[model samples]
Target: MLAFFIYGCDSNNKIWEVFQEKDLLKHPYASRCGDCHQDIYNQWKNSRHAKAYISEDYKKATHNYSKTKCLNCHIPLELSKGEKPQIRNFHKEDGVNCVSCHFSSQTNSMHGPYDVFSPPHPSTKDEDFRKAFICSSCHQETYKQWKKAKVEKTCQQCHMTPVEKKDLIQKFPFHWFHLAKEVYNHEFKTGKIKDLKVKVKKEGNTLLLTITNNQIPHNFPTADNGKPKVYVFVETFKNDKKIEEDNALITPKFAFIYNKPKILEFNFFEDFDKVKVVIYRKLSWQKKKEKITEKIFNFK
Candidate 1:
């Protein structure tokens, strides 16, 4: 195979020196990009995206990869804005790797939120890279809910929390040429979940707990193709002694809609003087539930 690149530099144009079209679309691999973007690669390596195809939970759910539809998203070959991705045969182990999300056949270049001249590959400045549609293909429902909420925050703003400015690349020569810009964490964490708005009201022997998905603009505990659950645990006490404990479950079918409230009721004797409520969420892909927010109420 012949390595091909047109070599020239004048601060305005950079002919491909290290990457040819075949190196990108035909022989795709994340490590090739990691040659320069070491920091970003390390962050992505530890993310759920890195394990999308290899996750035990995903494999178990798919019955050892028997479900073909599940494979596409888990080991997507490429991603197009507002469209579901197509599965690739090679590098399936990489799961949702760099090329899956960044490289576009449409543009025949890597798309990002910045404009830059690079010797290794072709780069295109794309506004869609900063928008929610970039994630809409995989996060269908959440994207829909986000649109309904009509907030200004994109999914990246929340999940890909911004980090301090630094060289986008780690290579010495390349690192010095590019200006530092706000870098987004490639780990893809949702960060600290905003606390939900909750209130407890007592009407004598009747107790009501209302939970509102405040501040968040999407459905709480939402998922695209998997079932996610939200649990509301309630406890009642009379003079500091817990007398009753119960819970209500909320699912994606009836998820905590954007700004709407879901009320749960507990009927007890009029003697109860205090109440405690705790919320937990079990995402579709997780085996354990984690506590989200909790509140206590006292009536003297």
Candidate 2:
């Protein structure tokens, strides 16, 4: 459950609501996102968000699970209103694409920093919609950290800050970086996630777990150089009773050697009956890593 409270009837708030809602398949944005922002359409075509599902990370993460849950964030509009794809098309869909956020039919009246207007979609357009809450729909943990720090901003405050430009289409570009100019516009750079999976096995009250970096195109957490962690955790319970726990932190430097199915073995007393394996994010608040855990039974 989320502790953050959303408010008001605005575009930002509506977007947040859409994120919180379990079913947004029938929303207009899911079908009619290409009407406006033709320029963004071309730019996003080559963006990381567009490639998220096709990326190695996504494939490995959803390899064995129902594709629907993964596609909700990766391909926002694919399964809307009972529409399911015969075969998963990663490149054509997936991730938090442009249409996912700016699907309204409203017009932009204000321009420049702190500018606010009704985005071109049927969704509600209000003050909260213009804030970072919209982006927080996916990056809930980062949003919590930002809220805890009392930062006076949203995800776009840092990720989409406009940069001054004289040789560009306008004076300011919402995204302003030149790292991947050839592949796509530097201004439209979105973060990438690597697939990290953990498998657990049991043998005579003892548990052994392995983790692998399955689908990282660039790196486990992101393509851009930064500090992050890939860690494994073990928690033991005996007949529904708490027993012991252990955690291991792995970094990119360490991952180079231990990238394979790195093994972690755990021994439990005959009294213990269950074990849990958690592959959680240890990266800083800014990395926006997703956390996953698995549990298994052990007979003693």
Candidate 3:
């Protein structure tokens, strides 16, 4: 029966194992993958993916899952390239778990970045896992934003940061079977605040501030469902006493897209000793805006 099932699949999508539909369904929990992939699984535990469905912020944002569209990415059955995964009917607590990204129902196997020889569950080589398109389904807007930037770097290049010469699995016997290769972090990464660059110019009492997203490759404070904000605070001082204070907010709608320059002009209309510019950011899930960077420009 399994042999017939294996032969029934598309030639290009065939995996090694002859697995029935139920065979793949047997292992339903994310923790099951941790038995062998201890390190990788541990990293995933600290990731936002782990908190996707259970996040209090997510629940509140979705109005307690009243929005059905939001559930697809949170507890996905299987994520496909170029399309959002279907919502799973069971184990919703797993929340974007291992099988959500790796398992393929079509072939009844785990699809990963590299081919594996395993006696446990079926795994096959899939280069699509190495590309940014795999992330496009859920990060639709950010994926579009990245495509506009026209950079060669994939989402994994920055988010699932690569470290060379590491074994993919850590379990004793599994480690003995697998060879060391380039390993990427399961805990997706975010850009550093220091990577943001600001240039200030003065023309009489007017200040021209050019903020460049030199490193962050996606929209600044980007969000799909929730509103994130970027704030630019401008303060002018005379004799060390503050004279004027102003702020500009960049919402997700009016964002500083990746590698783009956003310009702000502050017309003071009068002389001041110095000006201070501080930028703060609040991500979609954050409770408060955190300081990104600050700079002081002297007009003395």
Best by TM-score: 1
Candidate 1 deviant stretches above 4 angstroms:
1-22
lDDT (10s digit) by residue, model 1, range 1-300: 121122224433434443343576554777878888999999999898888888887888999989998877888877866777898878888989999988888877788999876656777898988998999888888999999998999999988988999888998666655678888999998654558888888998788888888777788878887777989888889989999888889888888888898888888764688888888888766789999888889988
Best model number under lDDT: 1
Q: Rank order by lDDT, top first?
A: 1, 3, 2
lDDT of 2 at 119: 29
Lowest lDDT 10-mer window, candidate 1?
1-10
lDDT of 3 by residue, 26-81 (tens): 54787878877788889899888998999998898889989988898888888867
Residue 187 of model 1, lDDT score:
96
lDDT score, candidate 2, position 54: 62
Listed per candidate, the RMSD to the true structure in angstroms reads 4.1, 16.8, 5.6
Candidates' TM-scores? 0.90, 0.38, 0.87
lDDT of 3 at 31: 83
lDDT of each: 0.81, 0.47, 0.81
Instruction: Encode model 2's per-residue lDDT on 65-103: one tens digit a residue.
Output: 356565555555322221321223343444555444444
- Predict model 2's lDDT versus the native: 0.47
Pairing residues by index, what is the TM-score of model 2? Answer: 0.38
